[model samples]
Target: MDFVLVHGTTQSPAGWDRVAKLLTAAGHRAIAVDLLTPRDLPVEGYAQHARDQYDGERPVVVAHSGSGVLLPAIAEALDARALVWVAAYIPDFAGGRSLRDEASAVLEPDWIGVDPTADPAKASEFLFHDCDPETERPALDSLRLFNPAVLAAHPAGAAPEVPSTVIVPTRDRTLRPDWLRRAGRERLGVTPIEIDAGHCPHLSRPAELAAILTGRA
Candidate 1:
């Protein structure tokens, strides 16, 4: 399947380096797009660009973290065959709340210090707990800073009928695992595959994560 990999907040297309390489090595075509700034533009205008620009048939829409909000629209617009979510916020039709609202409401971390904005210190401190110094170290250096103004803006929810699979990180500080699992059922009405990892399992445990994605697990 043609894979359209999307990075989460404060993350660029570069975040998918290891996973993309593995996909290529295995002969699966995987393309990672910058969720923070696609087409050198803001996230608000993503629905338009993806519709007109994407070139593929039955593309598997793989979205991570905050980027999950826009997948239903992209899939609807681009006519995607399936959506593969990796520790993403795959909410139902009435998507719980905006990322900004959700962050402000929760008490996650001091480094997270606040909502959805990029903070390398916080990332290293919170999100990458399972990852090693080598794994978290580089990601810290290249942390993608989103347009805070855009993040604070209201979030449009994903479509209800879009076919999707949610991959839950059982222990995530960035997003509650229980919350994601509930959303996967309540919103998507689908049972999710729960994994014991942090936010981005594709980085920390690529073999298992990929096996789950490729369905050899």
Candidate 2:
């Protein structure tokens, strides 16, 4: 099966390198997209970018973190076989709330900053604390600042009709596991698949994450 991986904000396709390697070894084509560029575009533009890059037949679309908001449109456009949310936000379609509102409600006091990418150290602490120093260093250096307007904008269109799965990282410091479970159930109507990892499981537990994605876990 083909897997289209959409990365979170402030990150690039490189973040899925390890997980993609594992999926490829298992004979599945894994395509990781970089949604950080053209930072001026809104959430719809990111969804269009993802849809434009996919050239396979009904691939399973997996989105991480903030990119989850784009899945509804991407799935509809691609006629995706399934939608997978990895430690991701399941937007409340009924509420018409933006990603920024959800983020601000949960922002840690230390996370307060005008520019999220300005301090690499704090970014690492928030995102890659569980990653190995060697792996985390380059990721930190490559971090980019995504336009806040994307988060502030409401997700375009309603949730798609594709079957969905939510992967909740139990050890994620960025998003609480309980909140993910509750949100996943309330919004997506699916129970989450729990993993013992941090926010970036593709970096910290690639093999294990791949197993789940490949139906071997």
Residue 161 lDDT in model 1? 60
Give me candidate 2's TM-score against the actual structure. Answer: 0.89
Task: Name the best candidate (by TM-score).
Answer: 2
Lowest lDDT 10-residue stretch of candidate 2: 106-115
Return the lDDT, model 2, position 180: 86
lDDT value, residue 67 of candidate 2: 76
Top lDDT model: 2
**In candidate 2, which residue pairs get closer than 3 Å at backbone N, Cα or C atoms, i.e. clash?**
none
**Candidate 1's error at 180, in angstroms?**
0.5
Tell me the tens digit of each residue's lDDT in model 2 across 1-217: 9998888776777888889899999999999876665456666677677777878888888888777777777777778899889988778776777777777553344444534477777777887778888888767765666555666577535766778889988877776678789888888788889988888888888898899999922
TM-score of 1: 0.82
Candidate 1 lDDT, 22-106, residue by residue in tens: 8777777777765443434444477556655567766777877776767776676667778887877654347546666666433
